[model samples]
Target chain A: MAVDKNLPILIVDDYKTMLRIVRNLLKQVGFDNVEEAMDGSSALTKLRESRFGLIISDWNMEPMTGLQLLREVRADAKLAAIPFIMITAESKTENVIAAKEAGVSNYIVKPFNAETLKSKLQSVLGAF
Target chain B: MTPSNVLAEQKLLRQRIDAAHAEAAQPLSREEVGDIVREVLTTMQGDLSAQDLGLYKELESLARYIQHARREIAAIRPADIRDCHLPTAHDELDAVVGATETATFAIFDACDAIGVIAGGIDGEQGVKLTEQITRIFEACNFQDITGQRITKVVKALKHIEAKVDALVAAFGESALGALEADPEPAGDAALLHGPQLPGNAINQDEIDRLLASFD
Candidate 1:
C-alpha cells in the first residue's frame, strides 16, 4: 500500500506550539494537508464536519484526551477506521498498553523529527 | 547555728575589702565581675530569645525545617524533587521546578531549531521548516502558561509562610521568624536547573519502536 501525501491530517494538542510543530513535521515528511484541534472534542467535531485521513493527538488534555478521542473515533461506526496515532510525552507502559488496546493505528512520542514521522506514516499507511 | 562559719566569712570578706580600701580602692575581680554581669545578661537573653526553652525549640524546629526546605526548593530548579532531603515539601518544590524547566526547554528548543535554518530548501522542505519555526515561536507561549502555573506555587508558599508566621506570633515566637519574612538568600545559592524529567523526554525513534512492538 502506498501512503498518500495529499490526504488531510488532523493534529490535536493542548499546546498550540505542538499543533504547529506536528503540522510542520508532517509537511516536512511530505504530508502537507494538515489541520489543527486544541482538544479531542474539537477534533471530533472536525472529524464529523470534514474528512481527514489521519489523527495525531496528545495524550494529556482537558475535556478530552487523545486516548478518549481515539476511543470515541473507534466507537463511531462511520469514523472507526480513520487510522489514529496517539502522540504524547507520556511514556508510561500502562498508558501505551491502554492505547494499544484501544485500537490506535499507531503512537508517537515527543521530540520526534521529520524522519520519524515519515517512517511511522510508512509503517501505518505503507510506503509513499 | 552557722554563726561561727557565717561570722568568719563576713569578717574575712570585710577584712579583704578593708585591706583593698586601705591600699587603694579595689574593684571586683574579673571572676566576680563576670558572674555579676552574667546574671543580668542571662535574664535579658531569656526574656528576648523566647518565652522558654521549649518554645525556643519549636522556633528552632520551624527555622531549621524552612531552611532545609529552601534547599530542597533550590534543588528543584532544574526540575525533579527526587533528590530533596525533606520529603514533606518535595512535591511543592518539584511543581515549581518542573514548570520552570518546561518553560526553559521550550525557549531553548525553539532557539535551537531557529539556529538550524542556514539556507535554501525548497517545496515541502521549506514549508516544513517554516512551520517548524512558527511552531517554535508558538512554543514560546509556554512562558505565560508556566508563569501562571508557577504563580500558584508561589501563592501556596506565601500562604504557608503566613500561617507559620501567625502560629509563631500566637505562640510568642521570637524575632528569628523574621528571617523567613525577609529571607536572606544563603551563599551562592540560586535555584539549580538540572535536567529534563527522564520519564517525559522521549525521541520519535523510541515512539516508533514502541508502536512497532504494538504491532
Candidate 2:
C-alpha cells in the first residue's frame, strides 16, 4: 500500500530548531502537510482542534511529556486510534517500554535522517 | 612592777593558763571539731572558686574567639560564587545553546536553498546534490545532541551549586570554608561519571534489544 503523501503530520518538540529539522526531513520524505507544536500540551490542543494522520513527538518535553501526551491520546476516544511515533535522544530501555506501553505506534531515536523518518512512517502508516 | 599592775598581769596570765588548761582538760566537742573542719573547707573552697573563675574566663574567651573566627571566615567567603558564578555559567551555557540553534537554523536555511536549487537541475548531479543535502540535514542534528549534553552538564552544575548554597545557608560558609577540595578527575577519567545523562550508557541497538524482551 502506498503511504499517503498528503497526510497531515504533527511534529511536537520543545526545541524550535528540532521542529524545523523534523519539518524539513518530513518535507524531504514527501510529506507536504506538516504542523509544529512546541510541546505536548500544545500538541494536545492541536490534536483536539484538528485531525492529523500521524504524530511525531519528542519524549523529553517539559510541562507535558510526550509519553504523557501519548497516554492522553490513547485515552481519548476521538484520538485513540491515531498512529503516534516517539522520537527522542533518550535511547533507554525504560523509555521505549514506557512509550510502547502507552500505545506508541513506533519509536525513533534522535539524530535520525530522513530515511529513518520515512522508514518509521512506513512502519506506522504502511509502506510508501 | 607596781603592785596593781603586777596583779593585773598575773591575772591575765592566769586567765590564759586557765583557758589553756580547760581546753586540754575537755576535748573539743564534736560540734566544735565540725565547725573547725567546715571553716578549713570553706577557705579551701574559696581558693578553688578563684582558680575556677580564671579557668571559666579563659573558656569564655575561647568561645568568643571561635565565634569571631567564624564571623571572619564567613566575611571572607566568596558570597557571590553561587549567586553570580554558577548562574552566569548556566546563562553562558544557555547562550551557547541559543547561538548554536541559530547557526544550525542558518545551515538549514542554506541547505533548503541549495535543495531548491538542486530540485531545478535535471541531471544525476541534481540527485547527488540532493543526497548531499540530506547528509547536511543529518549532520546538523549535532546541534540538538550537543544542546542536550550541555543541558545535562548545566543541570549537574546547578545541582552542585544548589547543595553548596544550602550548606552555606544552614552552617554559614565558615563551616565549610576550612575544608580542602578534592582533586578533579582528568582526561577521560572525568567522563567516567557513570552515565550521568540519558543515552549515555546504552545505544539505540541495546535499547531495542531490551525492548524486544518486552515483546
Candidate 3:
C-alpha cells in the first residue's frame, strides 16, 4: 500500500533529544511533514486537534505513558484508526505485551537508527 | 561566756544536727525513682543524651535506625556483599548520566565532522549538506532534556546531603559520624529501569526468549 509522506505524522517523547532524533529519522525515511509532542498528554491534545497518519511515541513519560496514550487513542472513535507505534527504552516482555493489548501497531526499541525506524513506519503505514 | 566562743560552739552544734538529719532521711522507692528517670528521659528526647540505662535504651533504638539506613546504603553499592544487591540505584543513575554524556558528545562530534566535510563541497552539493546540517541542528535538543534529568538527580543528592548533615550535627561525628560501609548495587525497581548498560541489560534475543516461554 502507498502511504502519503505528507500525512502530518505525530512524534512524541518526554526527552527532546529523542524526539528530535525520531523526527530526523522520519525525515530520512521520506516523511517531512511532521509534528512533535513532549509527552502523552500533549500528544492527546494534538491528536484531538489535528488529523495524523501515524504516531510514534516513547513508552516512558510523566503524567501519562505511551501505553496510556495508545489506549486512549484506541478508545477515542475519532482517533481510533490512526496507526500507533511505541518506542521504548524498556524491552521487558511485560511492557511489549501490555502495548500489544492496548492496540499498538508496532514496537521499536531505543538507540534505533533511521533504517530501523523506516521498517517500523512501513509496517504500520505501508510501503514508505 | 565570750561572744566568739559562743558563736563557734553554736556553729559546731548546728553542723552536727544537719549531718544527722541527712543520714536519717528515708531511701527513695523504686517506683519513685522510675518516675524521675522517665521525666528526665522525656526532657532529653531530641536534645540531650545521658549515660543512664533509660538513655541507653533510646540509643539502642536510634542505633537500630542508623543500622537500617546504613544497610540500605550498603545495599546500593554493587561492590558491597551484605545485600545481594546488583546494579544499585547509584550505579543506574551514574550509568544514565554517563551514557547520555557519551552519546551527546558523539552527536556533537559528528556534527563537527560533517561541518568539516561540508566545507570542501561545491555549490551544487551544498544543498544536500545543508539538509544534513539542519537535521543535526534539530537533534541537539537532547541537551535540554538531559540537563533537566541531571538537575533532578543533583537536587535529590542535595536533599540527602542536607539530612545526613543534620544527623551528623545531632550525633557527634566520632561515634555517630563514622561513615558506614557502602551498599552493593542491586535491582530494586523492576519496571522503571531506564537505559541499561551493555552488560547490565538483556538484549532483544533474551526478551524474545522470555516472551516465547510464555507462548
Using lDDT as the measure, the top candidate is: 2
Candidate 2 wrongly placed segments (more than 4 Å):
B1-78, B173-215
Weakest ten-residue segment in model 3 chain A by summed lDDT? A16-25
Winner on TM-score (1 vs 3)? 3
State each candidate's clash count: 2, 0, 18
lDDT of 1 by residue, B50-75 (tens): 45655545655665665565444433
Question: What does candidate 3's lDDT look like per residue over B1-215, in tens digits?
Answer: 99999999999999999998876553333444456666877777776645566665765566566556654543443222212232254466666766776686688568658867876887868658856765665555455456556657766765665665554444334433244554545676445756766697788999999999999
Highest-DockQ candidate: 2
Chain B TM for prediction 1: 0.32
lDDT of 3 by residue, A46-96 (tens): 999988988989887878988999999999999999999998766889999
Query: CA lDDT, every prediction?
Result: 0.67, 0.82, 0.72
RMSD of 1: 21.7
- lDDT string for model 2 (B1-215, tens) is 99999999999999999999876754333345556555655667756677666755565566566566655545545445676668777877887788788899899889989999999999999999999998888888888888889989998997878876764775455454655544678999987753223333688898899999999
Report how far off residue B53 is in candidate 1 (Å): 24
In model 2, the Cα lDDT at residue B160 comes to 78
* Deviation of model 3 at A46, angstroms: 0.8
| DockQ of all candidate complexes | 0.03, 0.44, 0.07
User: What are the clashing pairs of model 2?
Assistant: none
